[model samples]
Target: MQVFKEKTLLKAAVKAAKSNAKIIGLVPTMGALHQGHLSLVKQALQECDQVIISIFVNPTQFDNPADLEKYPRTLEEDIRLLKQADPELWIFTPTAKELYGENISAEQFNFDGLEQVMEGKHRNGHFDGVGTIVKRLFEVITPHKAFFGEKDFQQLQIVRKLIDKTGLPVEIVGCPILREENGLARSSRNERLNTFEREEASFIYKTLLKVNELFGTKSAEYIQNWVEGQFKNHQVLKLEYFEIANTQTLEKINRKRKGNTYRAFIAAYVGEVRLIDNIALNNEE
Candidate 1:
């Protein structure tokens, strides 16, 4: 696999690949390669002639400085894992100064209220941080297609809005959410979770499944109260928020309208390690 820590060398390589009429696929990440991340790379490999993986832990995205500090940065191990996946992969491991500048910060962008809910409310400037890096990556790589996992459903949606707003000539491909055998959503943060915490975390997904089953038959308000009570009684997990909302605009809806789609979203704190999960209440559009 060819890895580029400098954008100049990376651009020359990408330009060379482009000259050959190769279709480029981009998978942006923040190091810490997991099975779920490999799945994105694998999908890109299947569809495009070449794939680029960007690994940089963005600071502006983190409202809490401690969270950013605690974020994983196992570059050597990450490279090892990616080598196992594909020895021919292209990885862009840029420094904040190299990618942004000495003064690194997230820009302000309105994602048409897509950033005003869920993760946005909990983590301020998160989407703007996302947009800042994503815009830079899209500009730098200029790939034909970009891949993202649905685990960060809100982030995925905001990214869609971002591309639409910026009119960037790239396709945003949303991949299915990967989960553990115990039903916990696969996450980079999963590495920090303790054994007991990981087991307890399964309840988060089980509760989301239960919420999916309870939808329609149970009123939205009733389901909301039920989730609140479920986490309230739990020994380890604490419910941050649960909402059944319209899938389109992400606005909280009391009643599901006919011909409209909805999903059940849950965010909870498992001690210090926070987890978020969502499930489709009905067939997807």
Candidate 2:
């Protein structure tokens, strides 16, 4: 894989590929490639003639400076995995300075109602940073299609909205969340967990399953209380939020069975590491 750290060279490479009439697929990621990330890369390779994976730990997206500093960066191993996946795929791993330049000024973009709840409420300006950097990457790569994991279901929704609102000419594809044998969603942060913590971390997925079970028979209030109680009982995990909301709008649901579709999303802290996961409740039975 050709690794380009500069935007100019990466753009040139993409332009060259386009000139050859090759269909381009972009998989944007922060370094520390996990099975989840590789799933995205594999999907991109399946769909397009050329797959471009951009790995820049976007500093703008982090609400906490410490979180950004602590975020994993296993670049050597990440590239090794990418090379094994597809040796021909171009990997654009740029620095913050390369992508954002030296100014570092805060620019504003309105996300309508999408940015005010869940992750947005917990981590201030998190999605704005996400939107900003993603917009920049979308502009730079200009690929025919872009792939994102549904693990970050809200972020995927915001990205799709951003493309529609901005009229970006790239198809935003949301791939299914890849999980471990134990059902815990694979994430870069999973590397931070110790053996015991990893065992406890599986509770996040289990809690979601509990909520899913309670969806039709019980009220949202009951499900919410039960999920929250489990986190409290765990002691090791600090619950951030446990919500059942309209999957598309993300508006919190108070009553039960309002619609055919609902999403259960949770964000909790296992030690200093924050993890988020969601499950779609399709009441079709």
Candidate 3:
């Protein structure tokens, strides 16, 4: 696989792919590769002629300095896994200087309602950093399609809005969340958990499933309380927020109403590691 560290070289490579009338696919990641990330790469390979996976641990996305410092960086292992996935996939591993240079100004673009709650509220300016870097990558690659995992369901929603509002030509493809056999969502943060904490973390997905099961009969208020109770009972978990909101706008709903589909989303600290997951409720399907 070809690896380019400079933006100019990467752009040139993408241009050549476009010249040959090849469809381009992009999987933007913050390194520390996992099964979930590889799942996106696999899906990209199926739908596009060439897949480009960009590995840069974005600094702007972290609200806590310590969390940023603790974040995993397993580049050599990540590259080996990608090479195993496909020898032909282009791997763009750029330094922060290569992408951002000297300009460290705050991002100007803002997501309306989507950014105001859950992960956004707890991790201030997190999605702004996400939007800033994603916008930059979309410009550099200009791929026909970009792949993102549903494990980051809220981020996926914000990215979709980013494409819609900016009129970026690339389609934002949301791939399914790949989970462990225990049902815990796969995450780089999962590495930080000790053995007992890892076992406790699976309850987050179980709670989400319980909320989904209670959707139609229970009011949003009751469901929210029940989910909170589950987290409280789990000694190792610290609840950030448990919400039921409109899947499209992400506006929190207080009551269950007819014709409105909602998503049960939660973010919590399991030991020192933060994890987020969601399940869709009351869809026509």
Candidate 4:
């Protein structure tokens, strides 16, 4: 696999690939290769003639400096994993200076009211950072299709909006969330959890499953209260927020709309590591 740290060289290489009339697929990630990430790569391989994975720990997306600092940066291991996963995969590992130059600034992104709730409300400027880096990556790769995991459902939605707003000619492909055998959503941050905390973290997904099962019978308010109570039972898992909302607009729903789709969104802290998970409430028809 070829690795490129410079955009000029990466673009030149991608241009070469494009000259052959190959369908390009892009998977943008912050370099801690987990099954969750590889799933995107696997899907990309299935759909595209060529795949490129961008591994850059984007500083702009982190609201907390500590979280940014603690974010994993195992370049050697990441390379090793990608090599094992797919020998044909192209890796782009760019420095922040390469993408943003010496001065770093985030371009403000207004995703209607999508950016103002859940993760946006708690972690300020997070999505703008996400928008800035993903936009730059789209420009650099200019792939026909870009793959993202539905684990970050909100982020996936925001990215769809980004493509809409910028008129970028790239399809946003959302892959299903990969979970552990015990039901915990696969996340890079799960690495920081201790043994007990890791087990407790499974509660996040369990609660999501419970929400999905109870959706038809219980009211939204009742389901919210039920989830809050579940978190209270677990001392290590602190509740952040839970919402049963319209899947399209992401606004909290007081009553279930038969025609519209909805999902359960949850965010919580297991010890110091924050975890998020969501589940579909009903079939989207």
Candidate 5:
């Protein structure tokens, strides 16, 4: 795998695109490679002739400075992991200074109502920062297709909006959520959890599964209360927010429509490490 720290070098590397008609794919990530990330890489490898992976812990995306500070960075190990995933992968690892520079500014996005619910409601400016970095990278790479995990369901939606608003000639492919055998969603922050906390964290996904089970029979409010109660029983898992929302629009769904797709969205803290997970409700079949 070839690693480029500078955009100029990466751009030069991508110059091969001019001569060849091979489809380019991008998997933008912030280091700390895991099986979940590798799932995205695998899909890209299957579909695209070439793939580019970006590993920059975007400062603009973090709402809390402490969260940003605690964000994992294992570049050497990440490179090793990527090599195992695909030896021919083109990896981009740019510094904050290199990507953002001293005077950092992000372009504004009008996501309509897509950015005002769930994650957006809880974390301020989170999607804006996400939009900024994603927009910049999409511009820099200009790939024919980009892969994103459905683990960050809201972010995946916002990226779709980014493509629409910016008119970028790229397809946003949403891969399925990769989970552990015990049901805990694979995440970089999983590394921060202690043994007990890691096990306790599995409840988040368990509750999501429960939502899928109870969707047609129970009210959205009822399911929400049950999820909160489940977390309350386990003090280690601090429940932040849980909502049953329309999958396409992400607005809270009180009553299920006959054909509308819905999903259960969740965010909680296992110790200090925050984790998010979601499951399709009516659409599971």
Candidate 6:
């Protein structure tokens, strides 16, 4: 339950953990703690000797300034929530200035077209922001393994690529997307939804399920068309982008290629809250 707000202090603590032959795990997050985040923390505690959860709401990751401003920050509550899970947890809660310096911005990267579609296509410079913050966290925390939810499947892939490109030692572990009883993917943004809007948000997952159901029988084009049509008729959520892509390259699957794995990805806006979710079209990850 100890919190380190300074990077140097956190680094020293991680160094101590390493010197003690402890296996360190990292669960980097932007605060606004919920069951979904706690799920990652729980897994880290299970697999590693020690876990560090970074709760900084990274500024450089948001392409929209207002979105950054509106992003939730519940540090005290978050700490209490984490303490309930593990009283000995080491929490890194760095400020923007403390972590990124006075002139905060993202470090650009070439993920070999991995950053050029879906979330990247609509929101300019978003992944770079994500990359910058995540890279910084890896540098400071120095975990043996880092955990991320599969809700941001693209980000997870980019992080895996980041490890390859930078040759970082930490393993990137992708966890399942924890959802509400209605099937709405658990997200920090879910806090913004009202009771009714929250229920309506379940449509995003339901649509993804429909896409999965239609996979082998329907063409990629047909699934894409059907998804668009579903959102068009829906009165609640506005579909942003839906793509059926190979799990590896993330290239949109036009026609079913033999021996290729696929996944269904979707992003939609339920009011101002933009939520994203994905489902594996097959049994594979």
Candidate 4 matches the true fold with a TM-score of 0.98
Kindly report which residue pairs in candidate 3 clash with one another.
Answer: none
Point out where model 5 deviates above 4 Å: 283-285
List, residue by residue over 1-285, the lDDT tens digit for candidate 3.
998899999999899999999999999999999999999999999999999999998999888889889989998999999999999999999988888888753485678778888888888899999999999999999999999998788899999989988999999999998999889999998998988888889989988888878886777788878888887887789998998988888889976666777888889998678899888887543
Residues 180-265, candidate 2, lDDT per residue (tens digit)? 88788999998999988888888999888877887868888888889888888896899999999888888998764544478999
lDDT of 6 by residue, 44-85 (tens): 999999999999888777888899899998988999999999
Query: What lDDT is obtained when candidate 4 is compared to the true structure?
Result: 0.91
Per-residue alpha-carbon lDDT of candidate 5 for residues 1-285, written as tens digits (9 for 90 to 100): 899989988887787864588789999999899999999999999999889999999887777899989898999999999998889999999887787888676556779889889888888888888999998888888888999999999999999998889898989999999998889999999999988888888988888887888986888788778888888888788888998888889989867777789888999987788899999886533
The TM-score obtained by model 2 is 0.96
Give candidate 3's TM-score: 0.97
* Candidate 3: segments with Cα more than 4 A from true spot: 283-285
Point out the worst 10-residue segment of candidate 2 by lDDT. 253-262
What C-alpha lDDT do the candidate models reach, one value each?
0.89, 0.89, 0.89, 0.91, 0.88, 0.91
TM-score of each model, in listed order: 0.97, 0.96, 0.97, 0.98, 0.96, 0.97
Task: For model 1, state the Cα shift of residue 271 in Å.
Answer: 1.1
Rate residue 19 of model 6 by lDDT. 99
Task: Report the poorest 10 consecutive residues by lDDT, candidate 1.
Answer: 276-285
